[model samples]
Target: MPEIAGYRVSRVVGTGGMSTVYLGTQLSLGREVAIKVMLPEALADEVSRRRFENEARTIARLEHPHIVGIHEVGRTADGLPWYAMPHLPRGHVGQRRLTGDPQRVREILRALLSALAFAHARGVIHRDVKAENVLFDEADRPLLADFGIALRRGHGTRVTMTGLAVGSTAYMAPEQARGQQVDHRADLYSVGVLAWEMLTGELPYKADDALAMAIQHAQSPLPKLPPGLRQWQSFMDRALAKSPRKRFPDATQMLAALERVPLSGGSHGARLQDFAYGAAARLQRLPKPAWVAVGLVCAAAIGLGMPWRHLAEDVADGEAAPASSASSPTDASSVSAAAMAPGNGGIADGGAATMHGAAPLSVADQAIERARERMRTGRLATPNGESALDSLLEAVRAEAGHPQLAVASTALLDALGESATGAIVAGRDAEATHLLQAAARVQEAASPSASARANHRARVDKALRARIAIASRRVNRTDALRLVEHARVAGLPDATVQQLRAQAERIPDLQGRDPGNLDGMVVLDGATRPLAAFVSPVSRAGYARFAEVTGREPALCRERISLLRVLDRRDWTTPGFEQGGGDPVVCVSWKDAEAYAQWLGQRDGYRYRLPTTAEAASLAAAGGARIVSEWRADCTANCSRRTVAGASWRTDSASRTLDPDRGYDDVGFRLVREL
Candidate 1:
């Protein structure tokens, strides 16, 4: 256990990549607090150690309900830099009880945005904003904490946040991820990601690797959520735009926009604390003397070129007495590098020339014409994601040689996506995601025009989507152990793999022991394991597995489509497929014979289902009387569900050969299960 200055360590609270938080009681004040300490291993380097100390000093100055205020900043006896703040007992937003309630999600979003807005007005930029940084009080009022890598206006580079790359790549703004000079809006982009994950109960874009996930954040389209939640699409759209110009102007605008949405759901009476958590009102309540000290720090930061954090810390320790600054904090720039686009005459890095800006409409028309001409002539017909179709359009437009960013970033993303295979295969998804995202941000930054971005987006979407599919394969094969191993190796989310396993286990199998079903069941001998199982009816769960394997649903079984799809179709309203997995499978399907047989053979250690006519008749006779007509797997590629086992769909009908390729409506299947 570690203790903050004047506090006795109590218990472990939480941990992160660089630091661990602990619960402690102040020895002198007799109050509980959160003690944050950077890991000693991370402090071995000079810069990292200093940066940790700097974070403590930075957070000590902020005074707002939504922003954590540090009461003590000190180094531990072992020399580890540490700080203590008011203990928020409810834990983090994405952890513990705040995980998925929608209204709480909204409240958290509102609180964070308000906090960020307040910070920005104070000329502070919280460079890193993520769910882990958001804490809550016992009453569930959200608070934005952790300013380890914050950038203050007029501050010199004590330790550059860009060099350290302190934040999680998944939540970084496009510009921040690209290592560009940023503004307060960068925080808003991260807030957008938080909003999406909060509302949907999962992140919008997921990949086996971090680089790929980052690429998704940079280039992928806005995540498509369920239809009912589509009303909030525009809100998320503005929040997550790759270009900052497309997003809310600031956190204040975002907070207002979010408040307008009528979305509901969270804990009862949670809204009662809305007023208590207002950052604006809290800021107004702060004594005039404190604002005067903060104002002095800001004035010195701009006029004398000092680190704002150091000056602000002076005020926190009761050492400031200067008058308030002549200028207001609103004077700080709101727009960032992401919001500003290169116009016709803009020059990019390395002295490269970019977009020869003609009229916006004129260039768009000309670009479209050139694209059509290339398609008409069939030369360089298809565009790839690396450079995509930009080269062709550029060649035809004005002989401009090439787009500036196109040359710069396309080559980079091409190499990144190509190099991420090892990580994806080795189960290092997070690393792979960051690499891919870096490239995607570059590509996003390069597109000079909306048309260019659209074209790039379309091409990149196809490429990235295909990549995600490979990263996450949906399989329901006999060798489940191998599927489990592959999924683990690919770094697929544990939840997804667990869900698949749970679904597999629910299918009822004999588990190598006789169920002793006196009604109609026979577990064939191991020597005849090829038959799969001998059963008269397939359970609902068994048929569900069948659909997963073959893709299409069993004709008369519960549908494999989503709930929305079921509601959309009028016919499904009547005689719909039963959702319960234990019920017998319904409808005639040629796939039933093969699917049912395979699952049983794999489930139990014996074969009972895939037997031919002679083998099936011998084993099936052990059970009681059953329907004579049923589908079986005894045909070739062009075979139909019409007649398997030389039988018809009608009961007691034996016209198996009469229509081997024709399917009937009355046929059904009997399947077995496994754990």
Candidate 2:
């Protein structure tokens, strides 16, 4: 393999407008990375070189869960600026068509919005926010990349290229297409275009050339939303507004809109309003005797007037009046049933349900009360197999008459989402997956525009997504088995299904198998008398487990262990490790490594710490240069990133003390902890 700057080139992964990306492995970090080398032709131009370097520096300043991470920024001997980022195996969003489930597409868009918001908050404007820039990690998690035309506050746009439009033609905002001044809203506008493309498998506008396309975007009427995506018209309208004032104010506002989409109807393609109002219309058309009989039956089943009808009626008619004092809540029958809920948790337990001092409860309140109880008892689903999530979903979508209950519904959904998480922690992946998928299914079927429902539904959907994202990150030899079941039931992706099954067949149950392996652990004297060190260095397998268990990646490791960005030297960057099992990790400062030890110590209830000077001496005596270099917790001469003992990674390689503030790619450490 050809080696450049110590990275062994594997093969070409992709070619971008200004660079040919090579899949390479950093020799020191042992990580796979996409090295965006300035194209051989572009290298001749200083401006092109500056632009290449600018992108690297721009991305290096960002740190977000959803943004692409820049690992290293450097120049080749030929003066071409190249930077490395983690190579996501799943590829970019524009490269892959959105199929199978619309919910997943929403998630991808949500991630984009999140990334944009994060960048915008830091004064970064991703001028090019197209589908091609949104890449997916190994677990199908989205990562925003390619900030080539991005602008950070105080950094002027390229004035030299005036009148020449930048960014992708199909996704550019009208202002950007017209070479007019634009801000973060332009990025959001592009996001809208991507959303349209993902849903309908085509951009909102198309033409024979960039100039024609720009004209179309600048003046043409927006194409109709896809047949099923009519509910998204309002969002699309705001996003594609001709004027910047007409578009969403920023990424945060756009994210809220995206979250409220709820697949715009439901899983089976039915609008929540239609279902709720249809049910209400039925109640009104029925004979009074039949209505009373049916109400009585539902009351017996749920212990309340099936007040969902009133909520639907109120929502269907924006001018519906509130119940007046003279009418009394029970007598009004005009208020949403939720407005008339039994004043204190509903009277379904003993007597006729009635609202006293308070307004009647909304359908949401009843669901919150019922679902809360069921969730507490681990009754995610009923004995007859009815999902409690169904009630919770239906309730949250039906507007609550009172603001407090509306707030309560949000908290209730949080609790239900928490319960799903608890299931995962309890090692019941099947149940957690089932519950979350059930909630997602029920949630997708409804999209009520009421502020209460909109806000609460967004919150609930967030919780479900958190669990799924967590599961995706923690895919390991053991957990992969469990996650496959989740992917299948959730229908999140076929890739995850294939990934889990492939991992189960390939990776073996390795570390932590024995009670005293200590390969991935440290025990301090605080917890126990005797301490032990790892039998070997920490491995890629261990890093995977650490991230999964802690919901965090290690700090400043040379090996990019996770998909998320890491902070270093006033720069937000990432690592790129191809694979390192049994091989010692490098590029970690003593402080960060020590922090990891402390974190594990507290989390696992053990005393984990970096080896002291004496301990390191003994280890080195036994191993005889076993490591590229080892870090000692205490300083021999100076403090603050001063190394006490260890051989350096350089060819001059005599044992020497070095600054700890800086990390050498070949310098790794082992842990010592109380047993």
Candidate 3:
């Protein structure tokens, strides 16, 4: 990696057209950081360099918790300017599974909007508010990143490439797409697009190319939500208004509007209306004797009409009005019949059955009520028969066709979604997969319409896919294989399951067997023969033995200190942390690992060497959870550096190249025997 003046550049984490992001260490104070270095091409342009520096300075001033803070700014040896930020390893919001969980969706939006509101107050417009820019910290709190394209007030847009659109095309607002002078509202529009994606698992607009997408944002009508997501429609409508004026005026207003969004698929009033319609339809089927009874009740109600408005007020306030006062003639007849029926819980106890008297509470109504109670108590799907899911299933079996069924189903789905989200946030992929499957089953059983079923399944599948993607990155081979089959059983599309299976197959499986007794090594099946590899990085005790036998001085250590490299006093034995004899050694150079490999090969009468990149990748994927990165036998950049594969305890990144002769505190190596 090209040396940045003040930061110890590790390897490239991501690369874009204008810049590269490095997972780096800030030598001063020993901090792990992400360093964004402007590409030499972009740096060569005086305007681009100036714009980068100016935005870096401006964004550095933003100190909100949800905003990625710029720690220090400097230039590389080649004079490419770079800035450092806290290295957040939970990945970006784009990688998270957030569909069907409005609580989480709202939480993310609120955090981002709070960040935006803070920046907007200082006259900085993020310009880009897409999913990729919203990153999560280790705690899973979101931080708005990459404000390189942010526009500050009074700075003409010409500083950026003039007439060329800024911001991601997929999330661009109408004004941004038109390249018109924009304000904070444009960012709000982008957030609206993001919200739509989170709720629907697809972008609001899709096209063949960026230009087409931008045009759609500028001209196409806002897309209607699916039937199950209609509660968010009004919120989406105002948030995605094509005209800037029609959109939420600021992040604060947008936050307020998001708060107002109903938690279910439909509004309470809408549910009430559906119930009214369903009741009217059923009323026509009443027998003549029942109609006569209703007529007498109506006469009695008219005799006491003055109390009707007060009863309506009480019911609207969620307080149960007295049955005699609240019930219309029709409701009185329905209640009288319900009072005589046999049921369970609230209905059998005569509590909810007589209230409102809109309809008789069936076994389904009691079961749904129990489900709601279970949900409130957080007994979602555990403890077997007493779970909210169990109650919901009972309600489904009863097939009472209660208006509350729709709301109850949505609530269960949302609860399961939120729980699954919590599991994902906690890095429990297996648990998350199980929860999503539960949600899918519930949707399958409860959703009546083909479209509703499809929509619900799609939502569940989106979350499962995201969870599976996360597992693909960090889970072991066994877990990956399990998830592949689990996903198939969960009824995900066959193509998706097949693709996941294919990816999981890349991770070598140990098949539930312990590693061979060949010095804590595992024998992996090979194309031609068996290959034995260390299941963990070479330990301190093992490396010490090699060094003692060879009588070689510890490889020259050079740690990157702020603005310069200094000879590090620490070595494999004292890598700045207390270590067990079996603990993996750090501060060992690739040369050290290679030398030990040669020594061990001679001693064991076998060819032992650093694993090849492909082997390393497979091993890394199947290594389970690890904190140290391992050196691989892959050379890069004229053999000056070798590949370091695996995730560090602090990062979710895959692999990077480092100098083979220099030891890093967190880098080690594992050996593979060529059989």
Candidate 4:
């Protein structure tokens, strides 16, 4: 209840294993604040203390608006450590005060992903991304919180123990479940799963225990989803893929996918309600088959002459079809058969009888045929000696006789193969590859006589070998060479193998560099100024901000204010400016950095951006002289001196800088812009 460090801790708001969060108020700013105090147990252990210190240092370096801001860290009278952050008004999504509307869910998810993308760029991985870790402001804007299990590059020691997965099991990525080394992709997977839950009100996977859930994540298929999620199925499939490479590489890409899904429905609730009502209405309606059977039964009973006049009258009236003469044998027989059907008289099994006869073609068939005809007339036109390939294929498939079908299919397949080869010759490699693969699958599936089948297979084999050679010449030379060698050993034609080998030889070795690097590069704005910072290497101090800013207890208010300014200045650049690195640079909060990066990108050519936490670490670890010097003992002394001159700085002569033996305070940074 006592006031300290310009804030009054009213009461404990929440508690975690390492710290207790208190609802507090900043007297000067007249704003609510959330203060977290390190548990006494953490302070008692040296390793835990170091980790706590590192968390504070890492949190202070991030400068994104979507991230929770770290205001200050101090010690209570009893020597317990605590840190202050902006008080978020809204609680976790799982608290269930009222079910949030879909729009709110989507908005919250978008903000969280954006924040995560920022943190990831700077080499920080929030191993725990879940509803509980996200908070909302008074206006309901989402703020990503709780980076307790965040992993920093070049920081080998983990805050948590081995075999102990840090994130909620429901959101853990497959690799994380397996306890394998993970990267930014794991976070993307979690975001995707969370989004799925928000939309459908269900998790993609579920189990009774953590280990079982992990196993299910690794081995089981995705849970059966409600209808109408087909649009998002492809993205979900990729995101939930067991392999990390298959998921979107980061949260930014996942955000792009989410944006692509149209938000046409007013909100999730309204759409769901409409759908439910529509389904109920459909169930209430009389089935068409029942009516058809009823008509048939009435007609038959009339023909049988069992007080039949009324039956005939009813049947004719209901169907609006002309009544048949009872004297005609054909009409009588047909009527009797119809009446005996189960749907009408309950005498015959209508479904079985209907199946015995050739089923009438549905209206849907006509629609499909019309579409096909239009396509044929437009893109598949036969002109100037060119034949319509799709038309030919359709005609072949429709042929009644096996021999005729075999001949026609073979001809069509051969023509497609030639077309594919022509495309390759014309230097359209992508089209050629697609065409060849399609043709191969078609030929393999076609039905033909044994001799014809063997001949077609031979032709396809030669074409496939040629296509493989062409592909090998383009890229992936090693894979191509192995394929060629395998084909040769399998007794493929020597001429084809030789051609493949020759093509493979022509491919330049682009090995060691990533083939997908160009695709992965972020395009930033040209008009915006790019802000950049560096992260500090994580150290083993208690998970308290006091350990980060002061490296020990501060004796004067001047030192505390200086630390605040340092943190405030850290927000100048956005998270997008940093690239992934494994070393520490200037760290700011995630939310602040995201705002700066976004603003800069908008003002510039959209290329001005912040580097992810991972990217920042990468640049730092690259060992440029400037970066290395920025973290040196000499550099710290120089920076400290410069700050004193540049600002109205104060120092306590009686108080000494704490832990002079440790190097945690040597973090520094620089800024950059695209040329």
Which tens-of-lDDT digit does each residue in 231-282 have in candidate 2?
5766788889889887876565466456545465443214323332234443
Please give the clash total of every predicted structure, in order.
32, 25, 0, 81
Candidate 2 segments whose C-alpha is farther than 4 A from its true place: 1-3, 44-46, 264-675
Candidate 3 lDDT by residue in tens digits, 1-675: 978654567788999878888898766357899888888888678766776887687777887789988766766777777888889888887888788687899999989987887788678999989999999988889999888788888887876666778789999998888888888899999999999999889999999999999999989988778756766876888889999888776675566456546677454345444333233223334543443343344335435642332333223233334655433323233223232223322223334534344455566766776686566445678768998889889988888466777877776776665555445433456776777788777877775345545554565455455555544333246666665655665566788788777766754454554333353455453323345676778877778888889986776455565433344366776677666455678888999888999998788577788887766534643352277888888998899988988777645668888889888878878888754
* TM-score, per-candidate, Cα-based: 0.39, 0.49, 0.44, 0.42
lDDT of 2: 0.59
Q: How much lDDT does each candidate structure score?
A: 0.53, 0.59, 0.70, 0.51
The sequence of per-residue lDDT tens digits that candidate 1 reaches over residues 91-173 is 77777453435677777887887678667766788887987888888777888988888878887455665454556787888
Ordered from best to worst lDDT, the candidate numbers read: 3, 2, 1, 4
RMSD values, in order shown = 27.4, 18.3, 18.7, 19.1
- Candidate 3 colliding pairs: none
**Candidate 1: deviation at residue 435, Å?**
44
User: Residue 564, candidate 4: how far off, in angstroms?
Assistant: 34
Instruction: Output the TM-score of candidate 4.
Output: 0.42
lDDT of 4 by residue, 1-675 (tens): 544656767898888878888999877467888888888888987656766676676677676778887876767666777778888877876653322365566677678877876677568888878878778778777788877677887775365567656678889988888777788888888887777777677778878998898888888987544434544555677778788877765564466455444453334444333222222222223354544555455445544543233333334334322344333222233222222232322223344343224232223222223223222222222332233334434544454332334543454444444444334433445555555554554455454345544554464455456555444323455655654543343234688678667766554454643232121122122223222222232211211232344343221111123666555432212222332222232332222223334444455543333343324433444233233212211213633421100001122321122222222122232223332
